[model samples]
Target chain A: MSNSTSNTPEKDHKSSYRAEERRTLSSGEEEFFFDVKTSDMEVNMGPQHPATHGVMRVLIRCDGELVTGSQVHLGYLHRCAEKIGENVEWLQYLPYTDRYDYLAAMNNNLGYSMAVEALMPGLEIPRRAVLLRTINVELNRIASHLVAYGTYGLDIGAITPFLYAFREREWIQALFEKICGARLTYSYIRIGGVFNDAPPGWLKEVGHFCDVFEEKWKEYRDLLALNHIFIKRTAHVGVIPKDMAIDFGLTGPMLRGSGVDFDLRRDMPYMAYGEAYEAGAFKVPVGSGEKGELGDSWDRFYVRVEEMMESIKLVRWCLGVIEDGPIIGEIPKVIKVPAGEAYVGIENPRGELGHYVHSDGGKVAVRCRVRGPSFTNIAVVEELMPGTLLADSVAIIGSTDIVIGETDR
Target chain B: MELQAIHDTLKAAGVVGLLGCDEPRPANKKEKDPGRAGMPFLLVDPAEIVPLLTACRDESRLQFDLLIDLTASDPAADGDDLWVLIQLLSLKYRHRLAIKAHLPKSALSIASATAVYRAANWHERECSEMFGITFEGHPDPRKILLPDDWKGFPLRKDYEFPTEYHGISCE
Candidate 1:
């Protein structure tokens, strides 16, 4: 209920108190009794809050219900992943990569592996291994997006979609378990190739999953994306303009939601994405602001939902072309990368996951820097939160789809 | 644009501190590795970082609107200078350029690139706290990923890891 809607006698007295004080001052008499002073309240909404999605604290200063200022406090979950990367050997650092962005561990593994591989001049990834990497990465992308979709629904007070989204995500985890024997942080994508190939009937099972996911994707769209309540809460809230989005260095759905039409997978192709694009496997979906303002929370959320279908298409295309061959490349167990520095940026589900490796032509790395997308993408929230309502701030944070592991890594 | 062409354009635009490009060309069969195998970068003086980056963003032919990454890499523990690395991307031209600025330990300060690109705000903050390189003119110069009262620069080569924090054992 707003102050204007409630016309109680007490509120009328409080509202007219200031004018009455001015009028009495002119008459040279003091009649000040009511002392209703309201100032901006400082609210700490993080470090243990569910809306934060992880251990992040936002020190929000609000005037009544409107947020006046916000300062994001991080480092609660910082494990110094980069410091660990520099200390560990070239191949031994793969498992550490899985810990950062634990939801999309495969993409993290691929990013770290690709960076190390770039420093090795003679390393060649096998064809079958490349296809498998693409398939697993895309599958992980779907699983990551599903979590983003489901959690965003929960953030908007829709609970059923959370369970529905998790059901399909479990299937992807099961498929990963069959191959790598780990559900969440599967360090399957090794340096030159994958740790192992898909099991005998794994590809066919993936095909079945693609078919079932296509049907469920529509249900998700209807249940949450097109729901009136969800649209109303998200549309026109936390709208990031195109130039602002680029200026903040937002990637993935956040950038595309502003209609930037740039995807590292399509524009700056790596892995099998180039061939898949040439084969007309999938199309990059940019938000057209069908519901409300462009680049709002709804557009960003919708882009993640739509990207799930495109990922399925890319997976299907990879399933069509995967041939029987060696899965892992011929590299020594203890590897020594050449003396050089290389930076490899890949399209993680959240955004651009970059790994900059500096090697001394030895067993250990000199410096390892990870430019995590969540770390950069989360900076925009400080700009978006001041003018929005308290609830809309949660919606905006959910739309960013940041993993604290990636943000603090 | 290619690295060579981008270098020439910066020179033509009268952007100072044009300190030659470091292209990662393949070494000879019998030659030793030069520790340069990734993207080509242009080395620049630490004092001219702001104007050179502003030129890169303002030049129509360059139009490097996106600041991809801003970081500092400590090449050696005993080295006198720290290397400040900046990565820029142009959505219009779809090309990338890397800029490296050498900051001596005696004077580890440079103009903040936040004036040219807002994305550099957090990146510069992280670099300052990590490498102890002060970004002069930065709006908010605070520790990003570490505690406000934290001790030493962890990413520095010679820094020692803390044994305890607030009476809790870190080891």
Candidate 2:
């Protein structure tokens, strides 16, 4: 090009560009190219995002990759279940309870039924019905924890565990379907007792499922619970102290995961759990920080995984103590609950699900208040999200295992 | 501890505004009315809620460290007062207590329990929005389960269901 006379214009342009660059560098103006001015950017996750297991929105403010602040906006799935409870009769509210925590409908059913039954002083739940209720509730707890385990793995970018977890969960759902007509929202546990007795061979099938699940449980532990990359991403990520756990009103696995050996089923037993606890059928598994700090994300996830096995033990115990008898109490078709108010709290898979029913000697309840565990458990995310990375925020939210339907209801 | 013992302990602590205990009574043959057969609850003055809860939590014999649930209920469509219910649990002693504060509907406001337990923050917000009760010193008193510009308190007995919201039918 230098030898070619026709390329003079090209040579002039190249020389001028090089001279400009040299002059700018000599003048100390190159910092403008390397320096970046930043402000906190607000990012909205969910009401539709996948990380949020349901329709919940989290507004997060980030400085680069660090989360500086967060605000959780709920009510997206509010159906006013409390109001419906006030309007419906005593027995009609059971189906409404199933919608709050759809994944653990049996637990919700048990909670509401127990609360209403508390008012009927003369009502008696048959022995066989109590055993059946225990079996169904414990099995549902396993199914609920399986979802928590699977989705938490999915949140941490492990896909195989979710498939394995759901495969087992589906088997549980099928057992429920065989007993009741509906699979997802069975509403099987009624006010006095259960809707019906288990179908023939169903209990034996449950025993078989327990045997198979014990083998698959080991595979699940190896696949995701002990994976190196999963541990690195989750362990020590969102550590909540024991004081904070109690201060926030957290219960169930959330409280136990903080190394607080308080299980409502054992401490305040209900629905034959007291008998089961006395029988030494199962043990409460508290987080010991096996891989990281106690109350961290992995600790909470591990607690749920361990709880599934504990629930299996509980189901097996129920099967061992089964007897043939009536499956329901003698509840009137048109129920008229005595004039009184009772608050019955049962140990749901997530936490203490309390039902406060106030009656004025009428067919309908004057006030029906539900103390949803997911509602209280999810509130701590606001305190946990700040000072975490954007990716770890997902881990913390997933660890809470909140169903938005329960949160909003 | 039994309900009587807990109440005696609270009374001994010089806790002001103790309105005595409401015991359970079964339905009688003569009255034919199913009497209050539910769990006994302590009735306290709304103004002294903070002190009452503080005493319940701090007393050596009665260490109610966990605030299990906080909610409010309206008795009737035309009731004169709303009852604010607070359930407390002690992890150390494994005893539970239920305290109800009678807030007159004419003045539906009370001291927020958030000072005693941080868990009360969200519970107070929910009570405030649903029952139209004003928690005097709550940090964040925003509407929790309802929209920002909701028309009326939905949980109140006298609340009227709205026909539409934002061009969408609610009925």
Candidate 3:
């Protein structure tokens, strides 16, 4: 199909397509000439495109069939979350965090609450609350990763894997609903601890979920992870170097996929993670390129798969150690954080979610800033996008697993 | 490196304009938060920011390689002029340090950190558009989270909510 038979399909498709496009565009009897500016194009990939997964537009420039460069345009969903945080009471701000990373709302809640807690007097979390939080947040992480995995499958040509992943996610949502009232935006993780303690038999149900999920995880892997086409689309595409990943401030799986052994849960060891990590049973799996180039789209995709398994392991551990006690901490009804600033970062499913709170000894904060992980992580797409074919760019974006809620917020 | 050691090194290196640790801690919650606990920040002269941050990144022991965040706060209770907090993290030693610099309302500008950390590009852009502080040498300093012709910096405590944006009633 190439203009010359001397070229391979991979290298020649673009030339052939461009030639065909030119022939069609200038085919009239009237005189016509090929123009490079008209031939070479810039494509806007959406504030509404399904592939974008949320309200975001990617401005991509293409030479023939290959993308030459790109830029990310966000803020379509900017609700001024920070400005609202400054106006609302401390407790009223919890629900707004829910909408930031809606897929990982619990983690967002936990991160924001912890930042506020840093400003409180005598704010040490209880052991029982820690264990409960470890369970709930890790469960939320599993649910978040399920969305990422399922949608990545959707981004690729697979339909059934989305069903499989969502079926499991539904189970987790039901469990979360039993403990907290809502499913999607469950503002369960309050400032001091969880909104409430787990109901009786909830931990046993988690154990059951983990046991059944392990076998299903293998089947899900067999369906897509080992599929040759999935491998072809992702492997060796969007390769990122470790130093570049660090310089761009990618955290969580995005950083780990590039072979960085840094996870705030393990490194900083907040909540119940310190003891679990100290026991030496916790595992941090970096990209070994088991099936693709290091830090490629496949490596990023695989890291999420492996992290889901780790979340299950964490849930099991928390269930084993959880003790009976008060879930809520003794925070004052009319909360007045001291006049100062506090910043705290927690490992969300997407990456490092940090909350910065500046209070002027008032009922509401002076400024509540969020360093959304997806906001920073999404910036690396431009570095990975150029020189890749248009199709592969979709794979890279999907592999990064960003919720545009976090990106645009 | 311990914070005290990093503080001593900054002092010994003869970087001027750093306020001492006796600036009456921010509202007595210092005993709980570690980063700002006894957080003695260097009030770097605006002209010397690039060199100070570059040293923090390249220094052998206190390699503050990660630019955690670059944010501007109105700090309304303290001053009319806004303050910018440049947070740096050292991956080598697992320590974090803060650099505080203030910008007056008349000329709200400071040297950009993009030359030192590429991650600063977007954060700096966001900070500039939201708080109206100019990142002097940022490669592409455009309004990131707002419309290009947006009238005011929304994050400043005194910023009034617009009654309308481009003829659409916002009130």
DockQ of every candidate: 0.68, 0.68, 0.38
Work out the TM-score per prediction.
0.93, 0.93, 0.90
Q: Give all candidate RMSDs, comma-separated.
A: 6.3, 10.7, 6.0
State, as a TM-score between 0 and 1, how close model 1 is to the true structure.
0.93
Instruction: Compose the digit string of candidate 3's lDDT tens values, residues A1-409.
Output: 1112211122211212343333321113321332444456899999887778998999989876667678888888888998898889998999999999999988998999888887775676777888888888888888898888888989987888999999999999999999998999998888888877778888899899999999999987888877777887777677777888888878879989988877888877788898887766468778877665577777888888888888888888887777887877787788877655677888999888988787766799877889898988898887777656788878888989999888778
Off by over 4 Å in 1: A1-37, B28-35
Error of 2 at A143 (Å): 0.3
Which sequence of candidate numbers ranks them by DockQ, best first? Answer: 1, 2, 3
What is the per-residue lDDT of model 1 for residues A10-54, given as tens digits with 9 covering 90 to 100?
A: 111111123233222222454342244458689999899887889
TM-score of the second chain for every model: 0.95, 0.97, 0.83
lDDT tens readout by residue for model 1, B62-149: 9998898999989899999899998888888888888888889889899998988999999999998898999899999989889999
The DockQ assigned to candidate 3 is 0.38
Question: Cα lDDT for residue B137, model 2?
Answer: 86
Summed backbone clashes in each candidate are: 0, 0, 0
Query: Candidate 1, after superposition: displacement of residue A357 in Å?
Result: 0.9
Instruction: Give the per-residue lDDT of model 2 (tens digit) for A241-292.
Output: 8988988989889999999999888887888889998999889999988777
